[model samples]
Target chain A: MQAGKPILYSYFRSSCSWRVRIALALKSIDYEMVTVNLIKDGGQQFSEEFQALNPMKQVPALKIDGITIGQSLAIIEYLEETRPTPRLLPQDPKKRAHVRMISDLIASGIQPLQNLSVLKQVGQEKQLSWAQQVISSGFNALERILQSTAGKYCVGDEVSMADLCLVPQVANADRYKVDLTPYPTISRINKSLLTLEAFQVSHPCRQPDTPPELRA
Target chain B: MQAGKPILYSYFRSSCSWRVRIALALKSIDYEMVTVNLIKDGGQQFSEEFQALNPMKQVPALKIDGITIGQSLAIIEYLEETRPTPRLLPQDPKKRAHVRMISDLIASGIQPLQNLSVLKQVGQEKQLSWAQQVISSGFNALERILQSTAGKYCVGDEVSMADLCLVPQVANADRYKVDLTPYPTISRINKSLLTLEAFQVSHPCRQPDTPPELRA
Candidate 1:
């Protein structure tokens, strides 16, 4: 929406960042990627400079339309509002709510509980299991809800904002070794999403800053 | 927007439920509050019936406009979209993003990390202190962000969805023994918001399910 390309402060392996990356790509908006190393020296995101950019000290903060905004969904909604093409939200109010529901199920319900900050608090010994429990419970509910709402994507065949939230979170679940077989719908949807160029380019491993060993 | 009065499946002490309650009151949309206890008998929210209603087994699932929507912010957005009168979001795209940003900060950034499930996972001995850290860090960031945005409420004088989210979170911070004196902006905003009838009527203490001893 601004004259120059938007700048996204993101990390290579951050699911939240990947969510916004996919949204930007889906909208075909040009963006400059500014990597925030979340794992280096106890996180560059905590630095005073980045903190000034995002008082929350988190990534996927976008400098677009002359103001910086944090929270991936909020940024996505902003893009949808300011530059709405290949719309990510459905027109019907109820369908729009369903898409938002699926997104929130991942954003608020699952991701934060298993976030790196929370996992560090859980200690290395309990991190995987803690992530597993949160992800599985969320996926179980998502699968049940998606069964009623999904066609090909999370909300019908159209790729909506729900798909943007779903793919990155599914990647995080994979990283934590959460079993996906139980959630056939989620697993299937994720598999289909990965085949798309937008999601492919936005994959964590394909990022410029991804560790060589972790790169796909 | 629906023919009959909407039904909100909520709990007295649930911050998420309180968010929806405040939005409902602010919109002047009449709704029936159906209490779903989150603490009794190991949380009635985990019951088979309640789980069917909300697969996530969380409070603040609203049945309105002939469909049920979960997640407080999603519910509020739905209300804003379907009922445009007395708007909860500013019309400017950037300002709307700012309102959503504040709401997201409280919802995804703070609430989930300190949720009852997360607290239980932290263990009894660590729960309060853990909540304190999570909420304080969040509020500290929130205070900084609000300095530029807040006036009468979060995101200016309009009393947007951000205020609906903020008031309940401040209540939770008090419950966890977080000292609010450090966040003068948040404290001031919360104080001003409480003076409004919508926020007052929807307060946790004023809910029908509030215990006799807890009622104001």
Candidate 2:
């Protein structure tokens, strides 16, 4: 085992990073946070040091067990494997599949289309509309799925990884001014998830590198 | 367990669907293929029946163990959990993290950006260039990560989930005419993976729904 606290390289406003942050908090893993300011200095993630750590040049990359792991879901799954308490994935195989399906719908289907890098490629003039359309379309599908799957949280009331992904994407939807009126289930779950200490403490607004003006 | 063979709802040309197909083949799972042609009839995935199976309206939803699961990675993970033979994930924690990281980099970071839906939204004229650029950028990082992690396959000699994600994506990159010269590692791995029986049988050109003119 690694001697020191695991290091989490994160950006304050990145939804992907926020997902990892919530997982770390939920599992009660003590770790160090190093800010990789995605916007400042033309993205610290592109720097030689950070690039060496994570060739993908994205945050939240975690250093633990003497290895550095990139990709938020991968890192979280590692934690789930090693830690396994206050479990982020459901125990039942089918319930676990629901958690993963919901998580991937947001992570792959929704978030990637509207991320900072993709937005930059989308160009300044069309970014907002592009993000809004992507989020709305994804949420349309998500709302229908959640209507069937949700109880108190995504996948039958368990605070699974699906909830971890849900809250952050809802925050992004809010940022993009997506009309949540059509997604009552999503809105309700986001509201319910926000009340938890793990979610509140690990929120983007509460992060160490969150801009002073944006801090909660 | 379900009495009959598990059903895989798939489109022949979809990279995401191809990932699941490769996994199902690798596990030697007996499955029924139900075609959901994305192009014909304005996307069969949009029909009420398909939407009920997968609200995300994406192909490669799997019906197994009496539950329907969507998202390629989710379905693959469920398969790994249940079957566990000829494992898609490594036994070691760190190695598994490596496999998952590479898989997510392709699945979330790359495939989603250049998917049929995103390309349609990108508009007809710019689709080729948009896909080329996205695939090239993502492959740059993937090549670097693979250089470090690869043995006979991504994360080691084992044909892990990372390989399942890689072959389909490299096929996508080829479809967009992205130059593979800069990514020798990826090119070599793709060449090697193509020799495998599972990859061969699961290929897009070999799919049941593949157009007659496109069939291998």
Candidate 3:
């Protein structure tokens, strides 16, 4: 916990949490991580205390100097604005929109479909299949966009907000055993992103609170 | 389609389609809307012709001059960039983030759960229930944000991209029969948004390809 920084209520294995973590690290912002063991005892997200922090009952609810902000993408953007030294977004409007489009593609198009809560609703076998289908579908789109847009990172050579969004979701895709053979651009970007110390430190396995079963 | 504008492969009832329609209208950019009936002939989005436009086989694919762009959010941002008039996002970075947070709340957070395709995967009753649940959950979060942020629109009165995103999703929430009694702020903002000509022109009911069954 860094003094005067915000408080993040996050679960180690949560992709949403990982997104915020990567963003914070990329911006070199410091904050306290409050582990809300999401899978423990029927999910901590549903607990009354955590629920108060985020009515949506989701991971990665940030409380900064008494103001609580939910949603991973939102939180990252907030950080980007409040701390703009290592810019996560492009200064150019068109470029920013491109970054946002990629971010939304992952956040809306891919992540929700493979979310653990949604997957649990599908049967175990079907869940795996569903995860693969959604990931492949979303990654194929990402691959195409990357072919023209991806530089050293998702949008360009710079480590922008899009990279913050992509790395964790790509990690989730790997967890489901989805084959990336169809999306070489995405696979290459994923490989490139992993080398970043910011991304490396934010991996779920490295988080202090990640459960043993999910620490792949 | 405008003389030099893109060709949009859209379906009448797809929220994704509605999103792009509103963006085109907001930017005052003209485009040809080619109706690909999502439900007819086992969904036109899955047709080989549409597949050629979008390998992912999704509605709201755009043929810009020649290049194709899939995903509603991406397509909308592309238009905002390529057009760049009547700016869809706020100029201030923090305010823009706030706008996108709200947009994502609808675009990523709510729409996916209530989409026709996702609903089709589950049966009717479950579909209705999931639709209601996701809408209520999303709307509640939105209401809270609106209370803090709204002046005349979602992000401090200016008609930003957030309003464009919200109006259509709120329409879907109403279609799903999600009770709006609990979301007074969202209900109020939505009512305000409906008064806008841009929203009115893009409404699903007003579309030429809208099926009789879905019309109000």
lDDT scores of the candidates, listed in order: 0.92, 0.93, 0.80
For candidate 3 chain B, the 10 contiguous residues with the lowest summed lDDT are: B1-10
Q: Which pairs of residues collide in model 1?
A: none
Q: How many steric overlaps does candidate 3 have?
A: 2
Cα lDDT tens digits, model 2, B44-100, are 999999988898899889999889999999999999999989899999999999999
Q: What is the TM-score of chain A in candidate 3?
A: 0.94
Worst 10 residues of 2 chain A by lDDT: A202-211
Per-residue lDDT tens digits for candidate 3, residues A1-216, read: 224778888888888899899888877777889998777899988887777667677888887645677788878877877788798889876567668777877888889878877888766878888888888888877787777778877888888878888888888888889887888877788899898898888889988896678665
Q: What is the interface RMSD of each candidate, in Å?
A: 0.6, 0.7, 3.1
**TM-score of each candidate structure, all chains considered together:** 0.98, 0.98, 0.87
The DockQ-derived docking category for candidate 2 is high
Q: Per model, how much of the real contact set is kept?
A: 0.82, 0.93, 0.47
**What RMSD, rounded to one decimal, does every model reach?**
1.3, 1.2, 3.3
lDDT by residue for model 1 (B1-216), tens: 468889999999999999989888888898788999888899999999988888999989999878889999999999999988789999998889999999999999999998988888789999999999999999999999999998888897888999999999999999999999999999999999999999989999999999999999
Report the candidate with higher DockQ, 2 versus 3. Answer: 2
B91: Cα error in model 3, Å: 4.1
